[model samples]
Target: MFIELDFQDNGKQSNYQAISTLAQLGYDGVVFSRTINDVITKNDICTFKELDLKELDQNENSSFKNLSSLTLMKNEKKQFRQYSRLNIIISSKKNIFLLKKMENILKTYDIVAVFPQSTEIFEKCIDLPTIDIISFDLSLKYLIKIKYKQVNKAIINGLFFEIRYSSMFKTKQSQARKNTFSNAINVVKYTKGKNLLIASGANDPINLRGPYDVMNMATFFNIPFNQAKNILTANSESVISHGVMRKTYFGVIKVEDKKKIPKELEESTDEDEDEDKNKEEIEIEKEEMMIEKN
Candidate 1:
């Protein structure tokens, strides 16, 4: 299923409206995230178990109740999956050390993302085990530089780099749009298109696009066709799975083995036994007839 890691209800629409729209647009799952400033403290990790969105309690405002009350949201129509994510914005070097301090709290969520304000802050947190996704404010006047060495290290360590396409759509000014494109190129160039995630970061549901449309936009980064497909499908799954792993007990997760077994090696049932006996008797009769003829 294709997953979008960034989504928030920005007053233009309720949480359910945005998610329902995403489901209609062919997104199989989404990450509803809450952003935190500075070091996360006092067990502020806001994540929950997966549940059906249709089963939730409704408020007078005609929206799903407080987001903190739920962790997972599913829609039966598309079997759409919803999970919570936590984003931490790191603006200073000192905040990097605080990650280790709140390591336990960070693991409680299904997804954990970090936005580095500067290149220096990014380097310090590149190897952090608590982080699952790394995002940059590419629309800013002063963009964070993406270096191959650092991005390679992040990829090697199972970290996903995010590209928010909705940012470009949000900005009207030519300079901001130019910054978004320039920074996106830097990110795609250094990462070489591996472990890259494409998200809308969209508050307005209109900013969201279909999976194929998003994949097509990736061609602007010069990514190959087949590899570009992974930006949304395979890579997104890996990021979500890794995020779920963070919430696991010591990094272990249970998975089913669906490999097909050969029919020749399977045991026969009662009907097969009857057929086999008839075939054996026929073979014995044939052998006796041959002897008589001889």
Candidate 2:
């Protein structure tokens, strides 16, 4: 089983800590947060702002060129295809040149770009066969307005009681909340060509629940167990491997002799049998001696 954590909303830990936690959790990879802050400071992309329906460009002086060169050099410092596949989040109104530059960086690591649910932005940029992890955390009533139905996977980010309990239980109105989940599930099930994924939207590792815990939430909302597991496990794996190159990774080899018997108790049956045989022989010899004496 594999889990893909969406860490776009979390900021409590340093970048290294978050990455290390994913490694510890046995998560295949992470969907990293890429807001306006990281790219500008890291010199990944040219900055942009929107005004009156046009995207105004920024100055690309020698400093910008030098920074870009430095970033590329730093990128070259890493081994080719060294890391596992990871996801990067980007919004709709980002600069096109900057977006392309980001794509190049991600391509080195074989990262998947998860775009927002904007038709215009998707059409302009999502040209590569990169995976689309659709966001469905919007209200059930508003989610129906989204135009794209051909996403790679769908994420029910904040569906659990820990996140939605206030809206669900505040006024003792269970039916509406139940209907909302049912509607969302039906949309996911009936969507023409999209896969379903569920996430906790957890800011911390403690908020991440086990498989059975997620199943209980699904059961309470009348969702099937298999469906829940798919969202929680299978779909996440699909998203992680979507854009990455495949490799055959053979693990570390044991230096011990293969033909030797194992030291475990289950493998020690031969010694036990030998001891029993010796006891039986001794008893028979004693009986014969007793008969001779008689």
**Candidate 2 stretches greater than 4 Å from native:** 8-98, 108-132, 139-141, 147-194, 219-222, 246-294
Cα misplacement distance, residue 288 of candidate 2 (Å): 99
Residue-level lDDT of model 1, residues 180-275, one tens digit each, is 777887788888788888888887777888888887877876767677777788888899888766657433433323343234323325476456
Candidate 1: residue 244 lDDT (0-100): 69
The C-alpha lDDT values of all candidates are 0.72, 0.40
Candidate 2 lDDT (Cα, whole model)? 0.40
User: Could you say which candidate leads in TM-score?
Assistant: 1
- Candidate 1: pairs in clash: 48-71
Predicted candidate 2 versus true structure: per-residue lDDT over 31-140, tens digit per residue: 54333322322344312211110111132332222233223333666211112323333443343234333454444333334434454444333333323343433333
TM-score for each predicted model, relative to the true structure: 0.73, 0.44
lDDT for 3 in candidate 2 is 52
> What C-alpha lDDT, on a 0 to 100 scale, does residue 134 get in candidate 2?
36
